[model samples]
Target: MPEVGVTYFAGTFVRHPLTMAVVHAALRHMRANPGLQEQVNTTAERLVDRLHALLAAEGFPMHIGRFGSLLKPEWTQEPAFGELFYYYLREAGVYAWDARPNYLTTAHGDTELDRIVEGFEYAVGQMKRGGFLDDVRPTAQLVTLASDRTSITVPSTESQREVWLADRFVAGNSLAYNEGLLLTLDGALDEDALRHALQTLLDRHESLRARFSRDGRRLVIDHHLELDLPVHDLSGLGEAERTAALERLCDEEMGRTFDLRRGPLIRFALARLDERRHRLLFIAHHAVCDGWSGAVLLTELGAVYSARVTGRAAELDPAPRYADYVAVERHFLESPVGQAHREYWLKQLHDAPQPPQLPPDRSPGPDPGLSAARVDVPVDAELVTRLRALGSAHGASLVATMLTGFAELFRRCTGQDDLVIGLAAAGQSFHGQGQLVGHCVNLLPLRLRLDTADGFADALAITRTALLDAYDHQGVSFGTLLPELELTPRRQSAAAGERRVQHRRARRRHRPRRSGCRLPHAGAAGRDLRVVHQRGRHRHVDGAGGQLPHRAVQRGAHPRLPGGLPRPAARRLRR
Candidate 1:
């Protein structure tokens, strides 16, 4: 071969720049962490050992093969079982290619490996029960949809349907679904650059331009939508005057509601604070956005603006379609697994307690015309740190611990041993749903029973168990569960809007400090972990400062100060 002269052609084009860069970065990371390969191999072997035992014990005619960190299923029975296994695996929250090996890496740790084994066990059991091994081919349940440049229409998801029903109950008052975010920038202002960034964001996220059908049965997303950025110049005014004007603008923006069927579910405005400072206000309907999307919108906006300023392309993954999520949810709802989840909820909530009533200053009545009365309860960092430590000691999260305390508060106020607390969860645990910018929050009812003999630790343990059970069965929405239990909507407002109480477990964001953009603090509420209790139709947990401040106002309401409570209790949670 060396003696013979041959034409050698190099295929340099095969290596794309992006691919090469990723490879190089990965190599560098591997070099920096010399034991990464060994760690990954160890995890893979652990998984293999557990899965091998599981398959042998379950008497499945299949085995798993592993070469280093690569794993694949080897079937001893019919080959068609591979396809059947894929569907079952997906239902168990494991996404993989049919009959193809999955590569494990340093990112797969003990928690992930345990989940893999559990998913395999669940998948195998489902296949055996469903008689999938008897017939590899059943009627396909997956729904595939096509869309053009004009619009993408998909059936409404349970979360979206809940919003629609809430809207109907409110008699089309859009404020019940309105939410907003405000960001303060401390640098040179660029109106044109901001405009370009806004347009790019609209183009990137289809949900921002989403519109509902007249009957609220479908979600339609336009492929292209023009940007409308309203800039309010307040730099010419005095500092005090500017502050007043900004407050008024926020109130006005929050007050402006959207017609779900008409158009424009989101609004943007920029206020010029000074030569070097600016504030950005963004408002949208709850149908189009949620707490998680707030972070996504800003992150993408920052990435786009940075790329535009540097004259380079923004590096972002392809936008995942919300319609795809709708299809997947519909498939689940029609499956036997969904029915089992519904049955679990029905049994658990059959004898649930009625909603607790908070003590009111005046008799509870309609106060639609009255302004919101803000209540601020400041929690110290030291107290929060101790509470978190207590939660960790008992294998509980801060959320569960706080929910226990919230239950105690209600018990003290209403003298009810049994309490039901509404918890709002961001239902984004699906394979491709993490990066999605749509409304997928599910409200859960957490029922807790308190005995006078129970200690704090015992109470927390009970709360933790209840919270975990709720999460496992959260696939069924609160809206769907209501009619199943022969119960009317828990929340009813004589006024046209929703009354919500929120209890949030806040933690500081640990990120590298950057100069371009930052969230400005709003007095004590921003700096402390606050608990807000409203005698309204619904109560849930959410971040405090990011939402519109005007919605916090409720007339004829009084804040239960520390001095107002019993002496012994004032020295407990609030302290």
Candidate 2:
């Protein structure tokens, strides 16, 4: 088996002297500290053993040099550059580590070059102050081998500078730390008032004020902001322009790294567009917030803003800090609750079908990136009412109805009775007090199998059952479940399979509709009944028969039935 050892200086793995020097230096450093010396020695010894094991397992030569200084002809053999880029991002708090060559090129235009230079200077200043690098640990992994057989040099570019800044500031903070927020508001509002409200909301939430940093490889948080936040106006721009700007800003911000040795590790931006509308973007390295934090920020911001605008004192009670949630989560993970949840997921998804096979790209290249198109299905008041009535009749929630509808569509498309699709669940369920802005959002994979012979109501019930089962086991992170489920992509071949099986499962599950609407009934009953349905878009399909017959079916009382099944119909609607 190949050996594993760390090298302080740049060299080939064959040079054992260089590697041994590094190991000796590390040992001396460890010995200097009575407590850490023991810990470091133990860790280093174990890591070396693991490295040897890894080499034996992969049958690949093992080399441990500064990652940035390593070079091999085969490095360009595959898309290894991308993989290495991500590896550096994880290990060294840097991004685009493989883009050294591209970064060397500078803008020819004097003005553009000047701007780039300014940005680079700002980035360098930030780096020095540990501005972006405040909470991040330093690593020797930033070194990169030259593209040609030449000495490695740090290349410069505006994009690279921004990325470097963000990576220095943000990445690897914490898995459950805060993710930024995207807020959209109605077009009639006061920008200053909104900003004030947001500030107040931030002040109220301990997580918003939390400070984070890296204590070596470990993340630590202090629940308070190091700097005051400033809100800016971002109104009167086109959607594309706004999107582009936000993307750029996000990219720049995400690239920054913070010095953990410093006090605070958080930043906020409020972009307003006119008096009535705006977006508030809060970018915190994960060490500070998560999905739950985003929702908490939104809810609290809304409430605090509303209160300030209306001249009412906010009455929110004191809630526990994010550290509390961490404690709770840790406890739950170790407790019976986590084990039970895991067991439930194991049972529920044991035989689940894979995710749908997305349509092949028509793009010209063989890029591995994804392209997506969305079709919006509007549920007007009347349609919403009808769907709600149907769901009510079956004692199902609106989400249950939609899930059933989607299940039918899936059956038609994949021709598989057993199917699994992902669902998003908001993780708030009567947890402790305080403004709960953290990663509370979770993805849940729901499995539904349709017995072809079953009626629509039966199918709906099955969907409802599955949804409820998912809800019951929703505490586990979808992030965790995804890997556990080992969901393979739906195969094109399986799309033609047909299983004529019938099974009846019983239960009451509450699947709430995404939205509810109240519409006046046209019948003599004269009831103003509320209808609930999945909020966003719904698919419309031509009935199973010909165009004219399909139109007739839509016009007829059974408009929803014909579109519920059949491959051609589902495909047409999906398209």
Candidate 3:
């Protein structure tokens, strides 16, 4: 049986005393409409029942009951809450409840209460003015799975809280910005032309105006808007100062959250660097954009900027909008394409091993609790020249050569003949659509199993083949693959009998560093060597207590060139 508990608010749920009066006034008006009252009653009942079931199934120690503005709670005696909670989640929209034990008795001072009432009144007014509830739903796509046992459980209250907080934080911090290398031109560019180009880009991408709201606890997106991209002038600051300002603007833009009661969740900022050089920063929440989307924006902006600078009309074609991609994705997921991919994954991972057994740590927190350390294996200029020569000799790209080096690194690190590392591919393959911004990238996990005697050239051949295969099958989304692979979370069993399968399953494989991992890139200009350090932290579940490997190393001169390599200065000047 599920436990039951009460939820308390710091004060009356209505916020201000006047707000309660307004609410009472609204309620009296609402009472005159029998149909509206009926709908509200039904919604409330459904919500309560769903909450109860969620608590019971998740084995939440408490159940919530509302009396007037106060919620009553009860504690659970059952052990397995995850199964039931997830079941409730799928059946209904409830993801979480306020878990703070003393919620009801908390005191909200007068100032806070006033703000809450004002917000409520504003929200109610909007709702009455044909503001649909769907407009306020969150825009999170539901990640589905195939096997029942594949569901990963949020093991504790803390874990659940962390997920909630992470979602909220991510939503709150999204911006209309694209992460790209900003280049400052030495000459003035046409601002009006630039604005026109930007507006065209915004109109072309549906993600630029995607709105988010909550569908129960899950986030749902409604792509709506024909928005104009705002442009500003910042051509009067030093280069360093301009970069600093752009970075700050990016941070600020990414940190905004949408309020349903407020008008729109869009923001833009521009910074000036000097008389001729200027920087443009665009930010949008992940609710509307992804990494691949950023690439598309940069590619388009480059083209548009170039066109304007050259005084040539932009020669870009009218490509499909992001909504088209979503429609195509939905169709693909439901059609033969999705099925074939699912079958492929099913066979590949049919006898796959369990997740890697990471080393344990003692951390008492709700953060992903994962950390990472990176090392750059810099190839000498000569070696780079040699590698380029070798690639040209073998008809391979620089990317292929890099893959070979990575495979070698993994082979040495894991001591395994067969290795696989997931690579994120920029999804810009759509014809006449490389520049359209949206979440078009997918992480393709490539397997590289090299024979111990294999040379770099042989490994490169295999890497090339694997990458091509991934590109061929890039139509399927990871959201669809997770389910068919039966990669759901498993419960930690206390009984010894349950340990056998778990231990056996655990020994079978290795996983990569957590998501958002990036490699450091080094570049050289004139007499100075510039190394760009990309910092990334891993996201782990709460109570997992996992520590990623960390190391600190000193920077040193570039290794000696392999052979016949031009000096760094000549190379820079040539570029």
Top lDDT hit = 1
Q: Lowest lDDT 10-mer window, candidate 2?
A: 521-530
On a 0 to 100 scale, what is the lDDT of residue 272 in model 3? 54
Tell me how far the alpha carbon of residue 133 in candidate 2 is from the true structure, in angstroms, after superposition: 12
The Cα error of candidate 3 at residue 527, in Å, is 34
Candidate 1 structure quality by residue, lDDT tens digits, 1-575? 23555354232546433665677788899999989988887787778777767766666655465666877664534334457787778888888787566889877888888888888888888878877666432211111111112355567777787787665554434454676677778888667877888898889887887877657887767656679888899999999999999888877887776877645789888899998888898888888897677767777888888888888888988877788877777777678987877888778778766555444443434422222223334455555556667789889986776677676655665677876566676766643477788887776766677764266778888889988988877776767776667443553320112334445432222111352333222221211113532221112222222232322222212344121322111111110
Q: Across residues 14-113, which tens digit of lDDT does each residue of candidate 3 receive? A: 4444655676776687677756545544443343354444433332333344332333232222122323332332234322242322221113344433
Worst 10 residues of 3 by lDDT: 500-509
Error of 1 at 373 (Å): 3.6
How far residue 536's Cα lies from its native spot in candidate 1, in Å, is 27
Model 1 weakest lDDT span, ten residues long: 139-148
Name the Cα RMSD for model 3.
18.0
Candidate 2 — which residues are off by over 4 angstroms? 1-196, 209-219, 226-295, 306-313, 361-366, 370-374, 430-435, 479-575
Q: Which structure is stronger by TM-score: 1 or 2?
A: 1
Off by over 4 Å in 1: 1-149, 171-173, 366-371, 430-432, 488-575
Q: What is the C-alpha RMSD of each candidate to the true structure, in Å?
A: 20.4, 17.4, 18.0
lDDT agreement of model 2 with the native: 0.43
Using Cα atoms with residue i matched to residue i, what is each candidate's TM-score against the true structure? 0.63, 0.48, 0.50
